[model samples]
Target: MTDLSKRRLKTWIRLLGVTRGAENHLRDYLRRAHGTTLPRFDVMAALWRRRDGVTMSELSRLLLVSNGNATAVVDRLEADGLVRREAEDGDRRRIRVRLTPEGLEAFEIMALGHEAEVDAILSRLSETDLEALRDILSRAGRPE
Candidate 1:
């Protein structure tokens, strides 16, 4: 392989390793500290962002998860009184899920800890390093 090709392959591996490591750490921290799974937190985060609520299909699409997967999480959240599912006005078959007031409060608490955890995890990187890495990733993600 050409030198450029070889270097690109190594870079991809390093990127994947870093991504997986960070994800695993976050998952573990959430489970241990919050008594919640990453998927549950993700669902809450999505609902928190859309105060007006979102359809089940929209939630699935936003999370890039299957309908069944999103439904299961929503079901649990509803059971815990963290979220509510209301039938759409014009469409009986459609249900919009949203965080309840209690859910919003709960998520706010979790969000604070979540931010602190992330900051601690990435604390090794200086501000300049973070900016540089963010710039590189932003450029890499953009379509040519």
Candidate 2:
């Protein structure tokens, strides 16, 4: 590879490693402390942010996950009585997933916990370094 190409590849690999470690640690924390998984929490967060509820397609898109994966998370949430899946009013073929009262309560707790955990993790870096890293990652999809 060219010098630039090798550097870019190395950057990608390092970013992936850091992200994987962060995700694994957060997932384990949630499972042990909240009895929840990352995917389920992500779904709940998406639904919580939207008052109108969300379709499975939308959830898949927002979560950057597969349709089957979103469906499985919804199934587990429904089984736990935290979320309810219903047919859309205008289109019976389309289903919407909404959090039940219990789900909202659980999500509130999880959200707060997650925010603190994320803050703690990011707090290791100085503000300027954090901003620089954010700037670099924000340009990830831009044309070089």
Candidate 3:
């Protein structure tokens, strides 16, 4: 490989490492502090974003996870009365998932902690450092 190619590969590896490390920390934080798995939290977050609710397939797509994985998490949430599944008027196969009042309350609490935890984790970076990182990520095709 050319010298430039080798440097690019190393940069990619470092970026992946940082991303995974941050994700791992979040996973652990969610599990230990909120008594929730990352998958469960993600499902709640997506639903929270779309208050009207989303079809099962849409939920899976939003989370970028397989239907089976999303189903497992949704099943658990349903059992806990955190989510309710409703069949679409004209389509039995398309079920909409919505957060219950209790679920909303729970997610709100978890979200507060999650936000604070993230802020703490990223607090290591100065404002300038954060701006630089965002610029680099934007240039690398990351959405704003």
Candidate 4:
């Protein structure tokens, strides 16, 4: 492999390792601190970030999960009173999901704990490094 190929491969390896570690840390923290699983927290976090309700398709895309999986997760959230589903008056087939007030409160609590955990994990990195990491990952959202 060329030097550039080797560098890219090494970067991938580092990224995968770091991602797995971070995922585990977050999962363990959420479970112990909030009694929630990572997937449940992810769905709530996505909705918490959006003040306006999102469609099922949009949530599925944002979460990178299948539509059926999104539907099932949303169902559980709704049953827990953390989320509500509303049908569009003009389009009965369209459903929108929004976080309930209680959901917002719960998310805020979880988010505070999550941020603290992130800070502890990322304490070795300077603010500039964090910004660079954010910029690099933001590129993943770009279309091909």
TM per candidate: 0.93, 0.91, 0.92, 0.87
Query: Which ranges of candidate 3 are over 4 A from the true structure?
Result: 141-144
Task: Give the poorly placed runs of model 4, Cα more than 4 Å off.
Answer: 132-144
Task: Tell me the tens digit of each residue's lDDT in model 2 across 24-119.
Answer: 989998999999899999999999998689999999999999999999999999999999988998788899999999999999999999998888
Best by TM-score: 1
Candidate 3: tens digits of C-alpha lDDT, residues 31-69: 999889989999999999999999989998999999999
- Which is better, 2 or 3, measured by lDDT? 3
Candidate 1's displacement at residue 50, Å, is 0.4
lDDT of 4 by residue, 28-130 (tens): 9999999888888889989988878899999999999999999998899899999998886768799889899999999899999999999898999998998
lDDT of residue 21 for candidate 2: 86
Q: Please list the C-alpha lDDT of all candidates, in the order they appear.
A: 0.93, 0.92, 0.93, 0.90
Q: Give the range where candidate 1 is weakest over 10 consecutive residues by summed lDDT.
A: 135-144
Alpha-carbon lDDT of model 1: 0.93
Q: Quick one: how many clashes does candidate 4 have?
A: 0
- Residue 135 error, candidate 2, Å: 1.3
